[model samples]
Target: MQLQPWIIMATISAFLIQICLTVESPPSADKIDLGVHPLELEHFVNMAHSNQVERSCGKYVIPRVTSRVGFSYSANTSFYAFVNDDMTARDNLKFLQRWFLKFPEYKNRDLFLTGESYAGHYVPQLAQLIVQSKVKFNLKGVAIGNPLLEFNTDFNSRAEYMWSHGLISDITYEAFTVICNYSQVRREIVMGSLSPACSGVISQVSRELGKHIDSYDVTLDVCLPSVVSQSERLNQPRGTEKIDVCVEDETIKYLNRKDVQKALHAHLKGVSRWSICSEVLKYEYRNLEIPTIHVVGAVLKSGIRVLVYSGDQDSVVPLTGTRTLVNGLAKDLGLNTTVPYRNWFQGRQVGGWTQVYGDKLSFATIRGASHEAPFSQPERSLVLFNTFLQGKPLPEATVVL
Candidate 1:
């Protein structure tokens, strides 16, 4: 199918999204052309569930355009939306307004908002817009993976996480808290200078963690960048049993291939090479200070199901911080604990821990999963995915036939 021209409006920044129905798809004359192994874009939510769509399941195909949080479009232009430091979540909502207007089909469908990392801010803000707006999108639920919800709670908790996981020493952890919190440390970084005290302690922390470690997934091995024979590197043994330490290496090589770009109808807007994150994007760091946890509460009050899941292995947005936020939120809302916290099973063995509050809100941990839980443990993540869509809780215990 030759592509058609898409009108370029005010563009937003770094995000890409693909939409696929969870229902099983039937073998039909017109099949959705899912990007193959070597052809998909890099830095995509790894092990993206859309790839698992079964041919036997009758499904609907929605355009998985490059998103700036909530904007959606067809895969016609590989060119990105250039957004600057001044661009806020409100600006993202404006772009989403254009997206919803363009695609009327999304009106009736259940819109479950989901994001990882930065989208922690984007996804919830967008869902809030849909809920408040006059435009009637079937905004169902929102899920965030290892999100940055509240700056103080999420960032400051790093000290405890670092200490609890044995990543740093008792003395170093004490210094981290006593000298200055992690948020202050990050603010100094954004300002392009660190205080002598901040620098000294940060250096101490780094030395303890070491260059070989991946703060993203503290247990997983860090990727070796100076790899030769790209194909051989792609085929080499992964650093950890559960996570692919070097998936980024393969992604970089694959996306840069000329054949791969053509197959996906992609083009470099002006750059010489395709990169994982947008080079042109200038994100507003202050937005991180703006709390979105209250926005999440608003979503739940409107009767939308909310699920906040964490990959237990991740350290950057550690499960410690996320779990604390979820627990606190449950209490603040006066939401009853429908299911007391307990183990949830994937098969015969335990998958992770889960709890449901007031039956509409859930929090879970994916054991040994990375910042990108679905990529590390696809099967287990899928089980969670199915339950999220069904508005059910993650099982407290496994049952035998």
Candidate 2:
């Protein structure tokens, strides 16, 4: 069978949506919704065609920065939702095959698979499946951020992250690491058989974390559900530098709006509302234990490029653990570091730290960004996105006299 022609697909399987085709341009902030992202689907097409991204910052001032953009966040993608999201990967793949069949134009184009969070699994697995089957389109590469690659490493790293970041007491950290962890607590919750010891440690951790914190990106503020939820009021970007912590709530409100759905040609066929996460779908939690880092190796062995990046500020999937795993993967694959680990620049500032291995595999970190890197640091994230797609290394830091 001949491979299909060109391009990419952005996965949001958690929400049962597959981005079809998306167009973007210079982002202008004329949004009325405060907590919501300034750019929305309603205006993105026009904005993208505008040809100039208004920039803000000191010294490294750029008024109309021109660079390639992607659907770095779902905020800018055109997507098609699976009729039923509560399905297995096999089922989803079959649906996607049919979806691909419908778009004959997609045949023969190089297809790039990408996503965040659990997509570390979804993206790689789907790419592997595409390889196994005779699919149209070339498998380009994969990029995932702050993803859950290994459950033990990813979840267990929280103790150190919490302690180092001053989110938990030393006593709490010791017990949390020595006694229980986010994964263990979760397993207990899932099995409906919480150990007394696990319960106590979990309760302590929860108390320490508090409900007001967005544990995903500890540096970012939490969305006040009372204020952002069920209200259309706009507020200042209170999350981080420009990230509105409550944007999560804002997205929900926007998607559920009847006018918004109508505009997107979307509807809640089997659900009451559009949700970023699926509530009805029963995920096999065991899948988390099966590390995709190995699957990443398999992809590399197949000669496909792999880029595993992290948002350094994410406590949920701390950079420390991801660094260890990525390094180990490089060693296992016998891939030598092509570019030594060092700071990369966006303009004159260190955007993040990156390391490339054997040209085929690379790892990098987005400095001062959140778990959702783009949401927290859009310009920096866009830089990374552009570089990754171009198969170019992040810009090297420049020396100033």
Candidate 3:
């Protein structure tokens, strides 16, 4: 299986973490070759710089070509008219099988599947497939940040997270949980109809939270083009450290440029502009109801290391629910807590809390981080990533001399 001419591969070094995009595939295609666009390229570059992987790890490689299916710039819109988890997983398996055959160098190196948010589903499903298929890839582990493991647990936790973080009032919180929880709201939205009561509750919650607050990272400020234009703000120091709230806007602008697209060998097939997410893929909303925690457990049983980390500030997938689910999974497996719940360290500062179950399964949180932890708390997120890759526990408390 020779590498396709269209397949763009960027070799970093020993480490290979493929970012899994959760978009569905076209009905006609058994396997969709997901390309590395400029936006993702920028993301990984920032991640590498932030993590200082090259500075510390000598040589680090990020293979631009990921098996996880996504809408390619040149892909026909009508081909990927529908997508779901099961289909996406099958497509990913095929891609990985082909990828390994093409790049035999990565066959012996450590391969970790990593992604955030919906990747909770994609990563686990793909890993399970790999295990079941008995593929001989050196798959050491998997890590997902702010992942959606269980729909109800993940979604329902949002209300309490909002209230606890002071993003919503007590009254609003009560209504949000009782009247119309996030799960219900999501269900309604997926069904293409919102009940009046749910609608009112959602409206109140939204109004109370306000548009200025980013739900992804409640602590971070929202991007306001008028108040802080991208050009001006880029030169100024970010109040939230290195994170640019307007990076999405900047990425959209950069990727949409004719010169940039030509350089990356990417072009819009049917869409006018390159958006963060796919606009044409009609994904199966019902797939969200399918819990991947059990799939995660299956992977764990196969002796593969699993690290589920959450950014504490992420309201979208609250740490509380994730922690609870991990704890329950550990209990069900009867894995004693090898490491008790304690704060891990990054230099002198407290990074976040972590707990390990049976040494194989672990869960940790990145303090002051968003849904995309690395984008905000880069240094801390880097520490987590580095430690996980080393198969070591997160850094313990730093002792002052």
> Considering every candidate listed, which one attains the maximal TM-score?
3
Tens digits of lDDT, candidate 2, 55-154: 2100010111001111011121222222111223344355457645886554445445555666666666656666677566466777777777887888
Report, for every candidate in turn, its global Cα lDDT versus the true structure: 0.62, 0.60, 0.71
Each model's total of backbone clashes:
8, 16, 6
Which candidate has the top score in lDDT? 3
Best-to-worst order by TM-score is 3, 1, 2
lDDT of 2 at 55: 20
lDDT against true structure, model 1: 0.62
* Candidate 3 lDDT tens digits, 1-401: 11112332334543543322222122222111121111232331231122263332322222222221222522344445666788667766776677668677666766677767777887899899989988887777888888899989999999999998888999999999999999999999989999999999999999999888988899888887874565466556535335667766655666567775676565455667665556555677788888999999999999899999999999999999999999999998999999999999999889999999997899999999988786777678778877887789888867875
lDDT string, candidate 1, 1-401, tens digits: 11111222112221222222111001100011211111122232232324442211112332222232112222433323443212334444454455567666444656566656655666676677667775566667777778888888888888898899999999999999999778889889878899999998899999999898877677776777664644455565754244445666556666567776665555454456655554443344666687888888888998888888888988778888888898889899999999888989887767889888997889999888877776666667767766777676676565765
For candidate 2, the 10 contiguous residues with the lowest summed lDDT are 57-66
Candidate 1 minimal-lDDT segment of 10 residues: 22-31
List the candidates ranked by lDDT, beginning with the highest: 3, 1, 2
Off by over 4 Å in 1: 1-106, 226-242, 399-401
